[model samples]
Target: MSAPGRRIDVCNGDADGLCAVVQWRQIDPAPAELVTGLKRDIELLRRVHARPGDDILVCDLSMQRNLPELLRLLDEGARVRYFDHHAAGEVPRHPGLRAHLDFSPSTCSSLLVDRFLGGRRRAWALVGAYGDNLSDVADALARGDGIDAHRRAQLRRLGEAVNYNAYGEDERDVLIPPAELYRVMVRHQDPLHMLQREHVIGRIDALRTADLDQALSLGPWREHARARIWRLPDAAWSRRVGGSLANLLAGQCPALAHAVLRDTAAGPLVASVRAPLRAPRGTHELCRRFGGAGRAGAGGIDALAPGDLAAFVEALEAGDWG
Candidate 1:
């Protein structure tokens, strides 16, 4: 195989994943096809049909579950570059594929991309870190980079806004699909400009914060294990806010694992689980059991019907983790 004339970029739809590619494309200035989906759709590589010598770039998606597809792509002569902070499983020694993976609690795909690009677009990376709630890390990076507190706050708000836009059962529930949002983001090399020029970030924040206010007014889920279980009505707003709610609750009570659930017309409840910032392992295994997916500290589900609710509660209550 030779250097690629065709290029494809695949990523998770979260702010970090999309932003990483934004920075990369901004720096490199290339017209590549984008392959992405909802935040939960990490197996995007399988959907991409690339020929040998096609340049493929993967960002923010996990390698642990997509090794076969990735290896096949490499074997078929696609030049691949992977940037992620999730478990890579068995890393391969392949000349066609390159990887930059680091699973630090504070690291996100954007920062990983920032590192791989030597921080050429550090500002956008700051926004991605903030969106991922790598607060201290984002603050450190932003502050050290001569980004004032005002700008830092702006980035944090923008991060939350973009992240909020990603929560949904499907594209319809969200204000905009992740791919559409990515298009808007890619047009701007700097997130700050997007924050300043577009009302998108502010609108997202307003919607999310208002929802959190309502969820909080409902009362705590429990005092046990320093966790709060919030039950919400099934609606687009609930779907959008669940992730932000989990983050808001967990941040307010760092020792508490936050489980935000939305009742659905059918199927198990839709849930968002945030490990106690202090105890990231608490809800990881519990979610995995009910056909839900998540990291040890943070992750969520599309749905968990009524029958599964009891079991979901049991696992949460079990608190059976190191």
Candidate 2:
């Protein structure tokens, strides 16, 4: 008799990705090889190697970015199940692939997984929604689940802390590598229990708070009637704080689009862009003009030329985000 093929899981290392995997694994309880990395590592599919008859699970990574690798895996006879909320340009028709993709501004990969599982792990889904900066949606879901206000706050913080930990340029800049954090996270069925039992959550939250505080002190680098932009030097703290800072700014000033640019060791800049919360649209289109892609509400550029800063600002100021 032949042995069963390997089970491989690939996902973004952010809260939504990790929580989606956690929910699936909790229900399945099967051993699988996990491939994940920092939030900036969007091309994680390139690192995966699947064999014929192997089972591959993907979450939260952009299908547009990983299309080639996904096609290769399918051609190699591996069955893949994908869950994501990113902008998928064109989904190929393949019998070996099962895709769950939703591009709604208010939903996330975790919530999709929760819906797939019939809400068996709704609390984890709430944490992921909050981490993805969908507080209003998460709150509504929590209310439906009968979660009290205090517990809702706890889930939000937990989600934010977990999401914050995934922002670094590399694993060294983060308090804990996301894979290690996932191991700790998977052991707890209840996110609230993890918050109470683990000191790591507190440690990560403290570091996030400190980094956000430092980033806030250096006010906006550029501001316009419709947008605000901030620039950060290439440092460990700045690398760790960029995405979280952008999210905070978006929440604080929902009337204007926000851009957070961090200097990279390379000559180019890395950017996080968020559309105005009041009218979340056009971010993906805006980023695509500069060779980046994401959902409508949020997008990022891995390497934006320094020379294009003015053009980027001008575009932001004139963007039809609604």
TM-score for every candidate vs. truth? 0.90, 0.98
Residue pairs with backbone overlap in model 2: none
Write model 1 residue lDDT over 47-85, tens digit each, in one string.
987787899999988787689999889887789999987
Per-model lDDT: 0.80, 0.93
Over 4 Å off in model 1, which ranges? 1-4, 303-308, 318-322
Which candidate has the top score in TM-score?
2
Model 2: per-residue Cα lDDT over 1-322, one tens digit each: 7568789989999999999999999899799999999998888889987778999999999999999999999988899999999999999999999999999998999999999999999999999999999999999999998999999999999999999999987899999999999999999999999999999999999999999999999999999999999999999999999989999999999999999999987889989999999998899999988878889899999888989888888998899987
Residue 230 error, candidate 1, Å: 1.2
Off by over 4 Å in 2: none
Which window of ten consecutive residues has the lowest lDDT sum in model 2?
A: 1-10
Quick one: best lDDT, which candidate? 2
